[model samples]
Target: MTMRTFASMAKPGVTSALPLKEIPGSYGLPLVDSLVDRFDYFVTEGAENFFKTRIQKYKSTVLRVNMPPGPPIVSDPRVIMLLDAKTFPTLFDLTKVDKRDVLTGAYMPSTDFTGGYRTAVYQDPSEKTHGKLKAFCFEVLKMSRPRIFPEFTKAFDELSVEVEKEFENEGKASFSDKVDDLIFNFLCRALIGADPVAPGPASLGNSGPTHLKTWLAPQLAPIASSGILPKVLDELTIHTITLPFALVSRDYKKLYDFVDTRGSALLDVAQNEMGLQRDEACHDLLFHIGFNAFGGMFILFPSIVKYIAKAGQDLQREIAKEVRGAVEANGGLNMKALESMPLLRSVVYEVLRMDPPVPLQYARARKDFMVESYDAQYEIKEGELLGGYQPLATKDSHVFANAEEFVPGRFLGEEGEKLLEYVLWSNGRETDESTVDNKQCAGKDIVPMVARLLVAHLFLRYDSFAVDESSSSAIFTQLTKAS
Candidate 1:
């Protein structure tokens, strides 16, 4: 396995012909440096500033630095930061990068959290299980296609009612909270033919998302801060030390049982058709739905709305007009209707570029390889950890003009469409196809489709809406409907 050149990996003209330079920055002194970097990462500078200040210090997009969840949890916190679009795609190349145990970056959750199985996410393409599990994931997505649009509408219809009722009574509605509920419901209904709200084998009631959050929080705590605790306390506790999985074992068990009962058909296909054990299938199914599908939506839908809300009514009116026109012309809001609405599609793509649901992507160098930024190349040794902070990469000013601003039509037209290669929200480039051999998201197409549906539905039901962004979540303060 060998490294592809910067020119080969990135869009033409995105890479430079400049000579290689030594990677700058340092790990300082072992754990001491990691602890300080971790403190600055979580406590002082925050995620964006942590990288920004360093880029300014080193004056390079590619630098060596300490990533968080350092010493005890992760043996080494050292990573070569690939901050620009030119170098970020190297993380996608399996020929040179080993993806095992780097999904969450630096640390991996206990297999106990995943029913004593590694789950598909932790496996690299080189691993034997990767092919089977990834293929199964693709199969599940294929099975859910027919239900995806209808179930999305069903769930979002309920969400609109909830938002309307809340606004009528309380004068404002929390969009994040409402959307989270619908996303979970929609995933359960479409993927497994079970509803968390409906009574049955899958009826965990509305507590389903809560159960999943409880299970996921521990796994993510080492690399993430809850913001619920003081910065120092959060850093010392969840950020420094790995939380015991035993705490969430019961929550996980309940989720596992729910899937074992409700996802029996998916399990059957996994076992009989795909050669996985029933228990392994159940755990992977739960992870795919709970973590990947529901979790992706939990972060993504709110982001889409937040960006649109902040973009103001001018963008909203344009999108609403396009959505309504497409639906009317096609005689319904089906795939054909979605295909005709470029503004709606661009809005979703822009949101993904701006605030990718998963902000960091990780891989380890499989062998010695040279990676490049605009002006310099850095030789990465075998087994070196690599991290790509995608938000910064996607927002590269060279690739996107006015990258910081929310331009809803940024991805519209022939020229704009070419920029899709830069959208790395789904593990792989937006233009890249998801295959079992690559780490790209299996439901890559499905996610955008559902997201577009959510936006299209919102505009169809209401003319324009106003959001309060002072808080972390979007609060719908005003929703105007066409008379």
Candidate 2:
């Protein structure tokens, strides 16, 4: 719908002139209300449901919500939750807002921690530095696709074997841990051009793919907790504790040293050709590939597997048939073969629609702007934190039919292609081209390719697998072998 159309649907009660602080919302108890309620909302209903609850209560798409303050967060009071699709696109338009200032906030990581904010994710599109970094990343990622397919194929092959062994041994296989390790290794290999596992003395304590998880846990713990104490600790310890460990810890040091030693030609190009300092180039690479791409897969892969398992036999069969046809048509399991599987691609899109791993996109208004919802327009002040809770927008009833259900072929045809704009979980709209100027994921195409490959490989290896989601972790059981 157009802006004017959405503005006309604006509800009558909440006016644009109302002071943002006075905006109706459950501010909760003195100190802990927002925190307690937020925790409860996520714990009981999941992160996707958190915005739905607020939208229902506030009766407006935009609401002032309290969130723990950190980097990319200016002041807690400025945080605004957006629950509609119409204005969500504004978040990615870098010209409308300054991503660097908004994301950096009060805590710019010391050069020792991240080498500096030269990474594309943190840089404003207008900056020459952003263009250099973005171009370098895109070039590296594009060239790495050939490497990515085979690496992912091998990883998933090993994972299938691991799952089969687990199920045979214990009658059930919890694939989450294995999925995490597999993606971590795949991403490291794709980005750094080396296995993540440390060698020799560095391998003594923390040797394998699990090293990223171990090294990141303590550092991310505070940020995840999200409160005054955690924020304070994060600021104090990021440089002192996190940076030092990132440099010296066996697991982390290997990655750091790899960039330093030109483990990948990308690293060499970034440092020598681009004229970026070694540490700066290393930090940028780590942030773009490690923090953004690897971190995304860490969550995305397992979620895809979970949904595919839950989809049951009929859907699995359809996927398998499509994948098999594509593989045969292409004569191999290459990029063309993977891209040719329409049903597999649809399933990935549907999974992303139902449960996007990264559900929220945050931005700060460089100037005052009016954002319209289905029923009303709200004035967002300069420097105010704007968050688009993507799960809500992607599933808006007006946009998708049977929005809550997992329609496997939802995006398979022409009508389905029209719904692409609603799927904004990848930091940019599906219609938007990935570019250095916008926040669109540089690995947008690659991420889905990886998901499609996972599905293809799983079905190729087994006829179908059943999921036991009765417990906290999903266990894929009843592996019917392909004849």
Query: What is candidate 2's lDDT per residue for 13-132, written digit by digit as tens?
Result: 433433232344655554456455434443455455666777788778778765533322223533677777777787886655667644423233334445444466767787778777
Per-candidate TM-scores read 0.95, 0.84
RMSD of each: 3.3, 5.6
**lDDT at 4 for candidate 1?**
34
Clashing pairs in 1: none
For 1-483, candidate 1 gives per-residue lDDT tens digits of 223354333234354466657899999998898889988988899999999999999999999999978886756889998999999999999988999989878778888788789988899988998889989988888888899888989998899899889999998988887787798889988988777787776468888888989998988888777868998888768876777889998888878888788888888899999898888888888999888888888999888888998899898889889999999999999999999999899989999999999999999999886786788777788999999999999999989999888888899999999999999999999999999988999999989998999999999899998888787888888889764
Which residue runs of candidate 2 sit more than 4 Å off their true CA positions? 1-23, 26-46, 69-77, 101-112, 116-118, 197-208, 223-250, 262-264
Off by over 4 Å in 1: 1-17
lDDT of 2: 0.68
Best by lDDT: 1
Clashes of each: 0, 5
Q: Relative to the unseen true structure, what is the C-alpha lDDT of residue 364 in candidate 2, on a scale of 0 to 100?
A: 78
- Minimum summed lDDT over a 10-residue window in model 1 is located at 1-10
For model 1 the TM-score comes to: 0.95
